[model samples]
Target: MPAVCAVLAGAAACSGVPAGFERPEQPVPTPEGYVDASDPQPISEIAWRYGPAPWRTDAMGDPRIEAEMAGIPYAIEFYGCDQGQGCTDLRFVTRADLRDSDDPDKPASRQARVWQANRWNLERRFGKVSAGEEPGELILEMNATLAGGVTRQNLDAWFDWWRVALTEFQDFTAR
Candidate 1:
Protein backbone atom coordinates (compact mmCIF):
# COMPACT_ATOMS: atom_id res chain seq x y z
CA MET A 1 0.00 0.00 0.00
CA PRO A 2 2.78 2.47 0.82
CA ALA A 3 4.57 1.75 -2.46
CA VAL A 4 1.29 2.19 -4.44
CA CYS A 5 0.53 5.47 -2.67
CA ALA A 6 4.03 6.82 -3.36
CA VAL A 7 3.75 6.00 -7.10
CA LEU A 8 0.33 7.66 -7.32
CA ALA A 9 1.65 10.83 -5.66
CA GLY A 10 4.60 10.95 -8.05
CA ALA A 11 2.30 10.49 -11.07
CA ALA A 12 -0.06 13.19 -9.91
CA ALA A 13 2.77 15.69 -9.41
CA CYS A 14 4.03 15.12 -12.95
CA SER A 15 0.62 14.77 -14.66
CA GLY A 16 0.56 18.47 -15.49
CA VAL A 17 2.32 21.77 -14.80
CA PRO A 18 1.70 22.27 -11.09
CA ALA A 19 0.56 25.63 -9.70
CA GLY A 20 2.67 28.75 -10.73
CA PHE A 21 5.01 26.76 -12.97
CA GLU A 22 3.70 28.51 -16.15
CA ARG A 23 5.68 29.18 -19.29
CA PRO A 24 6.64 32.80 -19.95
CA GLU A 25 3.96 34.49 -22.02
CA GLN A 26 4.70 34.66 -25.73
CA PRO A 27 4.64 38.04 -27.52
CA VAL A 28 1.92 38.91 -30.03
CA PRO A 29 2.57 39.89 -33.64
CA THR A 30 3.30 43.52 -34.40
CA PRO A 31 3.80 45.57 -37.51
CA GLU A 32 7.34 46.17 -38.78
CA GLY A 33 9.21 48.77 -36.71
CA TYR A 34 6.53 48.71 -34.03
CA VAL A 35 7.56 48.19 -30.41
CA ASP A 36 5.01 48.84 -27.74
CA ALA A 37 3.14 46.71 -25.22
CA SER A 38 -0.40 46.26 -26.50
CA ASP A 39 -3.57 44.42 -25.65
CA PRO A 40 -5.44 42.53 -28.39
CA GLN A 41 -8.79 42.31 -26.64
CA PRO A 42 -9.80 45.81 -27.68
CA ILE A 43 -8.90 45.07 -31.29
CA SER A 44 -11.13 42.03 -31.24
CA GLU A 45 -13.88 44.01 -29.58
CA ILE A 46 -13.66 46.69 -32.27
CA ALA A 47 -13.94 44.03 -34.92
CA TRP A 48 -17.17 42.50 -33.62
CA ARG A 49 -18.65 45.85 -32.69
CA TYR A 50 -17.66 48.16 -35.55
CA GLY A 51 -17.01 45.82 -38.41
CA PRO A 52 -19.63 45.12 -41.07
CA ALA A 53 -22.03 42.38 -40.11
CA PRO A 54 -21.33 39.02 -41.68
CA TRP A 55 -24.34 39.47 -43.95
CA ARG A 56 -22.79 42.54 -45.53
CA THR A 57 -22.09 42.59 -49.25
CA ASP A 58 -18.85 40.64 -49.26
CA ALA A 59 -20.22 37.91 -47.03
CA MET A 60 -23.53 37.68 -48.89
CA GLY A 61 -21.76 37.92 -52.21
CA ASP A 62 -19.96 34.78 -51.25
CA PRO A 63 -21.48 31.51 -52.28
CA ARG A 64 -24.22 33.12 -54.54
CA ILE A 65 -26.53 36.03 -55.00
CA GLU A 66 -29.76 34.25 -55.53
CA ALA A 67 -31.36 33.24 -52.41
CA GLU A 68 -30.28 36.68 -51.44
CA MET A 69 -30.10 36.99 -47.65
CA ALA A 70 -30.57 33.26 -47.34
CA GLY A 71 -29.86 31.80 -50.71
CA ILE A 72 -31.00 34.61 -52.97
CA PRO A 73 -28.92 37.13 -54.87
CA TYR A 74 -30.43 40.60 -54.96
CA ALA A 75 -29.42 41.11 -58.58
CA ILE A 76 -33.11 41.54 -59.32
CA GLU A 77 -32.79 45.29 -58.74
CA PHE A 78 -29.84 45.76 -61.08
CA TYR A 79 -31.52 45.37 -64.45
CA GLY A 80 -30.05 47.25 -67.42
CA CYS A 81 -26.89 48.33 -65.57
CA ASP A 82 -24.49 47.33 -68.27
CA GLN A 83 -20.72 47.51 -68.81
CA GLY A 84 -20.80 50.98 -70.37
CA GLN A 85 -22.63 52.63 -67.48
CA GLY A 86 -20.52 50.33 -65.28
CA CYS A 87 -21.81 47.53 -63.08
CA THR A 88 -20.57 49.41 -60.04
CA ASP A 89 -24.05 49.65 -58.56
CA LEU A 90 -24.60 45.89 -58.32
CA ARG A 91 -23.18 43.86 -55.40
CA PHE A 92 -23.45 40.49 -57.10
CA VAL A 93 -21.17 41.77 -59.84
CA THR A 94 -17.71 40.32 -59.36
CA ARG A 95 -14.84 42.33 -57.91
CA ALA A 96 -13.08 41.91 -61.25
CA ASP A 97 -15.79 43.96 -62.87
CA LEU A 98 -15.21 46.88 -60.55
CA ARG A 99 -11.46 46.59 -60.94
CA ASP A 100 -11.84 47.37 -64.65
CA SER A 101 -12.21 51.02 -63.57
CA ASP A 102 -12.72 52.49 -67.04
CA ASP A 103 -13.97 55.80 -65.73
CA PRO A 104 -10.44 56.95 -64.88
CA ASP A 105 -11.61 60.38 -63.75
CA LYS A 106 -12.64 58.99 -60.39
CA PRO A 107 -11.95 55.29 -60.61
CA ALA A 108 -10.98 54.41 -57.04
CA SER A 109 -13.57 56.73 -55.52
CA ARG A 110 -16.26 55.41 -57.81
CA GLN A 111 -15.38 51.81 -57.07
CA ALA A 112 -15.51 52.44 -53.32
CA ARG A 113 -18.86 54.16 -53.60
CA VAL A 114 -20.10 51.40 -55.81
CA TRP A 115 -19.08 48.81 -53.27
CA GLN A 116 -20.68 50.79 -50.44
CA ALA A 117 -23.95 51.30 -52.30
CA ASN A 118 -24.17 47.65 -53.20
CA ARG A 119 -23.69 46.86 -49.51
CA TRP A 120 -26.72 48.99 -48.71
CA ASN A 121 -28.76 47.00 -51.18
CA LEU A 122 -27.49 43.86 -49.53
CA GLU A 123 -28.35 45.23 -46.10
CA ARG A 124 -31.85 45.93 -47.31
CA ARG A 125 -32.18 42.40 -48.58
CA PHE A 126 -30.75 40.84 -45.45
CA GLY A 127 -32.98 43.07 -43.35
CA LYS A 128 -36.04 41.43 -44.90
CA VAL A 129 -35.33 38.05 -43.38
CA SER A 130 -37.79 36.74 -40.78
CA ALA A 131 -36.92 35.75 -37.23
CA GLY A 132 -34.30 33.00 -37.04
CA GLU A 133 -33.90 32.94 -40.82
CA GLU A 134 -30.77 32.84 -42.96
CA PRO A 135 -29.75 36.19 -44.36
CA GLY A 136 -28.60 35.21 -47.88
CA GLU A 137 -29.93 32.00 -49.22
CA LEU A 138 -32.93 32.72 -51.45
CA ILE A 139 -32.18 32.55 -55.15
CA LEU A 140 -34.12 34.96 -57.36
CA GLU A 141 -34.70 33.91 -60.98
CA MET A 142 -35.30 36.75 -63.39
CA ASN A 143 -34.41 37.71 -66.95
CA ALA A 144 -32.59 40.92 -66.20
CA THR A 145 -29.84 42.90 -67.93
CA LEU A 146 -26.70 44.20 -66.14
CA ALA A 147 -25.46 45.98 -69.23
CA GLY A 148 -24.20 49.54 -68.83
CA GLY A 149 -26.16 52.67 -69.76
CA VAL A 150 -28.63 52.21 -66.91
CA THR A 151 -30.52 55.49 -66.60
CA ARG A 152 -32.49 56.71 -63.62
CA GLN A 153 -35.64 55.40 -65.26
CA ASN A 154 -34.21 51.91 -65.51
CA LEU A 155 -33.09 52.00 -61.89
CA ASP A 156 -36.53 53.10 -60.70
CA ALA A 157 -38.23 50.38 -62.71
CA TRP A 158 -36.15 47.63 -61.14
CA PHE A 159 -36.60 49.09 -57.68
CA ASP A 160 -40.36 48.83 -57.98
CA TRP A 161 -40.13 45.28 -59.22
CA TRP A 162 -37.86 44.19 -56.37
CA ARG A 163 -39.94 45.99 -53.75
CA VAL A 164 -42.78 43.68 -54.70
CA ALA A 165 -40.67 40.58 -55.26
CA LEU A 166 -38.86 40.97 -51.95
CA THR A 167 -41.86 42.15 -49.98
CA GLU A 168 -42.07 38.87 -48.13
CA PHE A 169 -38.45 39.10 -46.96
CA GLN A 170 -38.83 42.54 -45.40
CA ASP A 171 -38.09 42.77 -41.69
CA PHE A 172 -36.05 39.60 -41.44
CA THR A 173 -34.05 38.91 -38.26
CA ALA A 174 -30.52 37.62 -37.95
CA ARG A 175 -30.47 34.06 -36.77
Candidate 2:
Protein backbone atom coordinates (compact mmCIF):
# COMPACT_ATOMS: atom_id res chain seq x y z
CA MET A 1 0.00 0.00 0.00
CA PRO A 2 1.22 3.56 -0.69
CA ALA A 3 2.13 5.45 2.47
CA VAL A 4 -0.52 7.96 3.46
CA CYS A 5 0.84 11.41 4.33
CA ALA A 6 -0.72 14.59 5.63
CA VAL A 7 0.31 18.20 6.26
CA LEU A 8 -0.45 19.37 9.82
CA ALA A 9 0.44 22.91 11.00
CA GLY A 10 2.76 23.26 8.01
CA ALA A 11 4.65 20.10 9.06
CA ALA A 12 4.62 16.90 7.08
CA ALA A 13 3.20 13.90 8.94
CA CYS A 14 2.98 10.37 7.56
CA SER A 15 0.71 7.51 8.43
CA GLY A 16 -0.60 4.17 7.05
CA VAL A 17 3.02 3.30 6.20
CA PRO A 18 4.06 -0.34 6.01
CA ALA A 19 6.00 -1.63 9.05
CA GLY A 20 9.30 -1.64 7.10
CA PHE A 21 8.53 1.44 5.02
CA GLU A 22 8.43 4.05 7.78
CA ARG A 23 11.05 6.77 7.80
CA PRO A 24 13.89 6.38 10.31
CA GLU A 25 13.97 8.57 13.40
CA GLN A 26 16.35 11.46 13.72
CA PRO A 27 19.84 10.72 15.02
CA VAL A 28 20.91 11.34 18.60
CA PRO A 29 22.02 14.89 19.37
CA THR A 30 25.71 15.71 19.06
CA PRO A 31 27.71 18.92 19.21
CA GLU A 32 27.36 21.18 16.19
CA GLY A 33 29.46 19.96 13.21
CA TYR A 34 30.44 16.80 15.09
CA VAL A 35 29.53 13.26 14.05
CA ASP A 36 26.72 11.34 15.73
CA ALA A 37 27.56 8.82 18.45
CA SER A 38 27.10 5.86 16.11
CA ASP A 39 29.73 7.05 13.64
CA PRO A 40 33.41 6.05 13.73
CA GLN A 41 35.40 9.28 14.18
CA PRO A 42 38.68 9.93 12.42
CA ILE A 43 41.71 11.58 14.05
CA SER A 44 40.99 14.80 12.22
CA GLU A 45 37.55 14.97 13.81
CA ILE A 46 39.08 14.68 17.26
CA ALA A 47 41.79 17.21 16.50
CA TRP A 48 39.20 19.54 15.05
CA ARG A 49 37.21 19.49 18.26
CA TYR A 50 40.20 19.73 20.62
CA GLY A 51 43.02 20.92 18.45
CA PRO A 52 45.51 23.35 17.47
CA ALA A 53 47.44 20.47 19.06
CA PRO A 54 50.75 19.47 17.49
CA TRP A 55 50.38 16.18 15.56
CA ARG A 56 53.18 13.64 15.30
CA THR A 57 53.28 10.05 14.08
CA ASP A 58 54.66 7.33 16.29
CA ALA A 59 57.20 4.69 15.26
CA MET A 60 54.31 2.54 13.99
CA GLY A 61 52.89 5.57 12.10
CA ASP A 62 49.82 6.11 14.31
CA PRO A 63 49.16 9.77 15.04
CA ARG A 64 49.39 11.39 18.47
CA ILE A 65 48.08 14.74 19.66
CA GLU A 66 50.37 16.66 22.01
CA ALA A 67 48.40 18.79 24.41
CA GLU A 68 48.23 19.79 28.03
CA MET A 69 45.56 20.23 30.70
CA ALA A 70 45.73 21.93 34.09
CA GLY A 71 49.43 22.70 33.65
CA ILE A 72 50.21 19.00 33.11
CA PRO A 73 51.55 18.03 29.72
CA TYR A 74 49.91 15.05 28.06
CA ALA A 75 49.60 13.27 24.76
CA ILE A 76 46.59 11.75 23.04
CA GLU A 77 48.13 8.60 21.56
CA PHE A 78 46.08 6.78 18.93
CA TYR A 79 46.04 3.04 18.37
CA GLY A 80 44.51 0.31 16.15
CA CYS A 81 44.49 2.21 12.87
CA ASP A 82 45.33 1.97 9.16
CA GLN A 83 45.20 4.08 6.01
CA GLY A 84 41.61 2.97 5.50
CA GLN A 85 39.96 2.62 8.94
CA GLY A 86 40.49 5.27 11.64
CA CYS A 87 41.95 4.61 15.06
CA THR A 88 39.91 2.42 17.35
CA ASP A 89 41.43 3.51 20.66
CA LEU A 90 43.36 6.33 22.28
CA ARG A 91 45.05 7.15 25.57
CA PHE A 92 45.83 10.36 27.50
CA VAL A 93 49.18 10.09 29.24
CA THR A 94 51.00 12.51 31.62
CA ARG A 95 54.09 12.02 33.72
CA ALA A 96 55.11 14.23 36.65
CA ASP A 97 58.27 14.05 38.65
CA LEU A 98 57.97 13.16 42.33
CA ARG A 99 60.08 14.77 45.01
CA ASP A 100 60.75 13.59 48.54
CA SER A 101 58.98 15.72 51.10
CA ASP A 102 61.63 15.43 53.75
CA ASP A 103 64.37 16.41 51.35
CA PRO A 104 63.21 18.93 48.74
CA ASP A 105 66.27 18.29 46.56
CA LYS A 106 65.81 14.51 46.41
CA PRO A 107 63.58 12.33 44.29
CA ALA A 108 61.11 10.07 45.96
CA SER A 109 62.08 6.41 46.15
CA ARG A 110 60.32 4.00 43.81
CA GLN A 111 58.68 2.14 46.71
CA ALA A 112 57.47 5.38 48.23
CA ARG A 113 56.08 6.68 44.94
CA VAL A 114 54.37 3.33 44.26
CA TRP A 115 52.80 3.43 47.71
CA GLN A 116 51.49 6.93 47.10
CA ALA A 117 50.07 5.92 43.72
CA ASN A 118 48.39 2.94 45.34
CA ARG A 119 46.79 5.13 47.94
CA TRP A 120 45.44 7.49 45.31
CA ASN A 121 44.20 4.63 43.12
CA LEU A 122 42.33 3.05 46.03
CA GLU A 123 40.68 6.31 47.00
CA ARG A 124 39.81 7.61 43.53
CA ARG A 125 38.76 5.41 40.63
CA PHE A 126 38.77 7.76 37.66
CA GLY A 127 42.15 7.62 35.92
CA LYS A 128 44.91 5.08 36.57
CA VAL A 129 48.13 6.29 38.19
CA SER A 130 51.43 4.44 38.37
CA ALA A 131 55.18 4.86 38.54
CA GLY A 132 56.71 6.09 35.34
CA GLU A 133 59.69 4.60 33.46
CA GLU A 134 62.11 7.06 34.99
CA PRO A 135 62.98 7.11 38.66
CA GLY A 136 60.94 9.55 40.75
CA GLU A 137 58.37 10.03 37.99
CA LEU A 138 54.67 9.18 38.28
CA ILE A 139 52.39 8.49 35.34
CA LEU A 140 48.70 9.30 35.03
CA GLU A 141 46.72 7.80 32.21
CA MET A 142 43.14 7.63 30.91
CA ASN A 143 41.83 5.61 27.97
CA ALA A 144 38.99 6.07 25.52
CA THR A 145 37.62 3.32 23.28
CA LEU A 146 36.37 4.24 19.81
CA ALA A 147 35.97 0.71 18.52
CA GLY A 148 32.24 0.95 19.29
CA GLY A 149 32.14 4.69 18.63
CA VAL A 150 31.78 7.50 21.16
CA THR A 151 29.69 10.62 21.38
CA ARG A 152 31.47 13.97 21.31
CA GLN A 153 29.51 14.99 24.40
CA ASN A 154 30.75 11.90 26.22
CA LEU A 155 34.29 12.61 25.03
CA ASP A 156 34.03 16.11 26.51
CA ALA A 157 32.88 14.62 29.78
CA TRP A 158 35.90 12.32 29.74
CA PHE A 159 38.18 15.32 29.35
CA ASP A 160 36.48 16.94 32.31
CA TRP A 161 37.18 13.85 34.37
CA TRP A 162 40.80 13.92 33.20
CA ARG A 163 41.23 17.46 34.50
CA VAL A 164 39.83 16.50 37.87
CA ALA A 165 42.10 13.46 38.03
CA LEU A 166 45.14 15.55 37.17
CA THR A 167 44.35 18.16 39.80
CA GLU A 168 43.82 15.54 42.49
CA PHE A 169 47.11 13.85 41.61
CA GLN A 170 48.98 17.13 41.70
CA ASP A 171 47.60 17.97 45.15
CA PHE A 172 48.26 14.42 46.39
CA THR A 173 51.89 14.46 45.28
CA ALA A 174 52.45 17.89 46.72
CA ARG A 175 51.19 16.76 50.11
lDDT of 1 at 45: 28
Candidate 2's displacement at residue 90, Å, is 1.1
Question: What would the per-residue lDDT of candidate 1 be over residues 1-175, giving only the tens digit for each residue?
Answer: 9999999999988898877766435423344432211222221222233222132222323212222322333432222222222222232211111222445443334435445345545765322221111222223222334222234445445444544444433322111
**Model 2 scores what on Cα lDDT?**
0.68
Candidate 2 backbone clash number: 0
Model 2 TM-score is 0.68
In terms of TM-score, the best-performing candidate is 2
- Candidate 1 residue spans exceeding 4 A from truth: 1-137, 141-143, 169-175
Worst 10 residues of 1 by lDDT: 91-100
Q: What is candidate 2's lDDT per residue for 129-155, written digit by digit as tens?
A: 898878789988888775545566667
Clashing pairs in 2: none
